[model samples]
Target: MLWGCFSSAGTGKLVRIEGKMDGAKYREIIEENLMQSAKDLRLGRRFIFQQDNDPKHTARATKEWFGLKNVNVLKWPSQSPDLNPIENLWQDLKIAVHRRSPSNLTELHLFCQEEWTNLSISRCAKLVETYPKRLAAFNGKPGDLIVINRLAYHHWAIYIGENEVVHLDPEGGDSSSSLELLSFRGEVKRQKLTDLVANDSYQVKNLLDQRYRARDHYVIVKEASSMVGRQLSYNDDTYNSQHFARDLRYGEAESRQVRRAACPAWAGLAAARAATNDFSDRRLLYRSLKRLSK
Candidate 1:
């Protein structure tokens, strides 16, 4: 889950986000962000949200939570992320988040807040410029593409059947898979039906389904249409629409070039970029693209 705030000398600030892990709605926080952004606008001035179509963000509940305001949520492409700019910034933020080594939520919050304030504007702009690369990554393999993390709860895994592998998952115990890796975490390795079972290094077979608690744990990257697409639409009414549109263009381009395209993060970058575009702020745009291509 991620939250983004856009600020400018003219409009003050606006807040937006992708959502939370459990998918819980945070109206108070959302409103707080809006109110923060609203600080800059004149009492009657209008600002946009550039919201995505995540259903969670656009549901009647969200509208009710936001209530009536001078704010307008923009319409954006349904599943495009390759072009959204903020996605790129969020990636850096996540990397920074992962690197922070916070002991608890309070520490994490403080670190995150500082990071947010210190974020460079040049990096934000490059996120928009790197659309070509994003489109390239998604040009193929567009369906049911699992992120396939290697480190389960930051550890290794086990083996079970032919073509099946297992893991000690974060949710709790062990899990195995014949079609794909266990739900826990592991790098994607193409092993033959015989070889997967034969690997000597791994502990072969957990047998108990109940033992594998983390087997059900999955970090959803895309939705039925595409996580990227939904994020593109999210906050289109704010400032991420252009980023989403840019992602849509990349997705379309990749589809044309290869026939498939996946990689939801690219769309997140598109959203970030759109936010920057919204206020005509070039803060992080330049640097973001450089980091993305690398």
Candidate 2:
């Protein structure tokens, strides 16, 4: 067996594993090669170490080794195949080493090392550059609520899988300026999550799941997908980004931001009752009452 890693910086140390591999031997390989590889690749402090959830990789000793080194290991998803860019390099290395036709173990090791080094830095960078799309690919199951934090406020969407989301994009499409998101007319649009997120940070946040039961995943996805390309006049008090996502996930449209800004403190319980009773269509009436009471 063999072990290796790569980054936008370049390929890391490649080690040939002998005999049956276990936790101790796996830790030994990482201890011997990981730090040196990081230094050689010029990856400064704060680089996240990613590895599969193999039994040996997640063993107690391995966890201790990382803790001792203060390495920030990425929490890999269970049952998910490793999608690190190094997988692509492995394929290329196999083809190149095969052409040499090594006859012995010693020759095979030598050819593997040579081919690993021959992998181009540009190719490594391109892989890393396009990695985000793949990173978001399995983040959420279908119909899961996803949130993008745009500094001032959060943009909400429902994951329909394949790195795409069902979201309400402003009529002119998303704007680079965060302020523009405060108020705008929008339409339900199916867009790539990466394209919608741009440089902003996002995560799968199935918020309020404890308070409100999530609808059937297939039903949520089907209903949300059906709204694609439908126009919506943006109204924080009635229907907004968060409301749309919540409606799909929970069969109720409730925006905490809108309630806090537009509703009175005395009306909190009443507002909750309204949401539970499916009085969403009467939100405009409630908003007018809030204004009058204030």
Candidate 3:
């Protein structure tokens, strides 16, 4: 097997593994070849390391090495080969090598080196650039909840798939608009997937199934869409995007009792209470504990 790393600027060193590679062996190769390549390419501390979830790659020793070196490893999902650019590079290399019609192992190795060298920097950069789009596509399933934390506040949106999301916007006008027509703080609007996630870090909450009993996704989406352009008071406690999401999923009324300051955290707690059919404020703490214990 062959192991390599590349960046938008250029390809890194390619190391050929002749036999079985354990965690230690893999670490050695990374330390020797990969680290040297990074240094040679002047990557400095700006690059993020990407690796699959192979046992050897995720071994405790390997993780400790990264921590000691202060290396930032990209969090990758398991069994997601489509998101790994290196996999595509390997396929391209294989195709290039086969075209050479190498007759022996030495010739095959030579062909691989030549093919790896021939991979253009622009092509490598293009592959790297696809990372975001791949990630967006992976999480762009219908009815998926996308949450963005903007330090002092949090925002919520429902992914409609097809690179679009339907979200309640406080500043949205009373009309339907495309994703491109809406801003982060705009009124309830449908916007492209990219606009929602521009530069902020987001998470696929996927909490619908957990918070409420499974329902037809189409039904949930339809309900979410019906709320588009519908005006609701924007109170952090009673009516906000989180409340909007809960109402769409659970069909429950927002809690009006203002026992504390309104915030997304409080909204979430209220939603959790509603999920368990516990809407009363009487002995709230005990009731919540009992429901949780059950």
Q: List ranges where model 2 is wrong by over 4 Å.
A: 138-294
Q: Quote the lDDT for 77 in model 1.
A: 55
How would the candidate models be sorted by lDDT, starting from the highest?
Answer: 2, 3, 1
How high is the CA lDDT of each candidate model? 0.38, 0.74, 0.66
Candidate 2 residue 82 Cα shift, in angstroms, is 2.4
Query: Best-fitting candidate, measured by lDDT?
Result: 2
lDDT of 1 by residue, 216-268 (tens): 11221122223221211112122222222222223334323322232343455
Q: State the lDDT of candidate 2 residue by residue for 1-294, as single tens digits.
A: 899988898899999998889998998899999999999999987789988788999998899999999899999877453556666677788879999999998999999999999899998998889777767654678889888877444678898876578987544333334343234466799876656665456788997787777888999889988999887766544456778888888875444543455556434444454344333233333444565587
- For candidate 1, what is the TM-score? 0.38
Write candidate 3's Cα lDDT for 131-153 as tens digits.
77766655545676777665335
